[model samples]
Target: MASEDLKTIIENLQKKGKMAFLEKTTPEKIEAFEKENAVTLPEKYKAWLLYSDGGELFLPAGVQFYGIEHKPLLNVNCEDRPSDDYVVIGALASGDPILFKKNSEEVAIYNLEGGKIEEDEKYSDFDAFLIDLPSGILGIGE
Candidate 1:
């Protein structure tokens, strides 16, 4: 889906009261975050951050996103995730994390506990990932 489509999706969700924004981060802040982490945030993911920073989704879909994080805790928070190469962008209620490669926009699901790869899915970019979020897990589905 295009960026406009994503906006419409978010707008539609907002009308249903399932959208919430964590905070908005400035370009300088996000750039600082990238410098601190020594990784470049994917363009699409960065746009998502500049759009809403991050927040939660419920009802039709459920995810607590770790966006650019409006505060100064982006580095610390990302480091707290399971792996260094996989940044936890969002997660399911089961605690499985939805990760994105540090240097790539590609997305994936890595089960931390069971150590099993349930989906083995990959998306070219963050937009594709969001537009095609799978259903039936942690309340998010097709």
Candidate 2:
């Protein structure tokens, strides 16, 4: 989606009780982040960065400024896993976690605290995982 459309969707979601935040990243900052991480961000993630700077993009509590636990995983490397397409974002409510998959296949929800990959299902052809923002819950996971 275009940047403006994404913003609109975020706004609508907030109206429906979803928590969202937006941040605008400058070209210099993006370059610095990449350099610091020593890896390039995926296209979708890059778009997200360009759309806004680092902050809470969607959370009812309102977006916190940079350095408020908004860490980009683009540069943080992970241990080798079976699925090269997987991009584990971070933890969430109820011990359930959120993740993004590179392939346009399915969004994987894992209960890391429970020690299991709870759910794997296809949602759309989009490249990013859209968590159930309002509930701070992911439907795919158990």
Candidate 3:
């Protein structure tokens, strides 16, 4: 779905009093974050961050959408991540990371299985991933 649709979803959730969001951040701050982290964020994801730096979805399932900031509550620099190629943008209630490739829009879920990190699921892009988020959380999609 498009960013507009995502905004609608968030708005509807907000009307229902089911969402919690952080203050919107500036493009300059986002750019500085990219430079400091040595990673380029996807354009669409950046758009979402501009909407709300970070937030929590309380319905369907709890999801933490991380922000590009140093504040512990909004930070996305997950040091225990699997690799430098991936950055954890959000996480599931189960503690599984929702990762995005550095400088790319590709998103995936990295799960710990058999003592190794494995791609449990993958999405072609950030938008597709966000579109399916609720269904994925409800166990209604692959």
Candidate 4:
């Protein structure tokens, strides 16, 4: 999705009472997380984290943004690092992974049910992913 589209999506979620990320995690924590992972977060994602450490957006298909302390990619454990070539970041309500490559910056959906990776170049980054995702799981929509 385009930048403006992303903004509109976020705003829509907010208007619908689905977006609620409050400022929580600290910069030091975020820094440690990055250092531990050995990856630099993109600017938009980094800024969102700084703005709202982490929170949930409810839409029945609720999406949870991993907080500095939550480890959204590492499955709630910073020790469980994902393999190279792909890094796990967030997940669908169904527990499927949302991953991306370092250089590409494109986010892909991984199906836990099929053990398959699906990449259609649909989402380019964190913001885009959030905005482009389906309204939500069953019963979680506008």
TM-score leader:
3
lDDT of each: 0.65, 0.45, 0.70, 0.60
Model 4: pairs clashing at backbone N, Cα or C within 3 Å: 59-140, 60-140, 61-137
RMSD (CA, Å), candidate 2 to true, equals: 5.8
Q: What's the residue-level lDDT of 95 in candidate 2?
A: 30
In model 3, what is the error at residue 82, expressed in angstroms?
A: 2.8
lDDT by residue for model 3 (73-141), tens = 434567646777788888777778777877678887777443235544777776677666666543543
Best by lDDT: 3
Candidate 1 per-residue lDDT, tens place, 49-128, comes to 87778777664456666766543234434543446776767765566677677788887777767664455456778777
Clashes of 4: 3
Error of 1 at 38 (Å): 0.4
Point out the higher-scoring one by lDDT: 1 or 4. Answer: 1
Kindly report which residue stretches of model 1 are placed more than 4 angstroms away from their true locations once superposed: 1-3, 12-17, 59-61, 71-83, 116-120, 134-142
Q: Residue 20's C-alpha lDDT in candidate 1? A: 66
Evaluated at residue 24, the lDDT of candidate 4 is 54
Better structure of 1 and 4 per TM-score: 1
TM-score against native, each model? 0.74, 0.53, 0.77, 0.68
Error of 2 at 49 (Å): 2.4
Clashes of 3: 0
Write one digit per residue (lDDT tens) for candidate 2, span 5-45.
Answer: 56665565556544444545666776776577554444544
* Backbone Cα, N, C clashes tallied per candidate: 4, 13, 0, 3
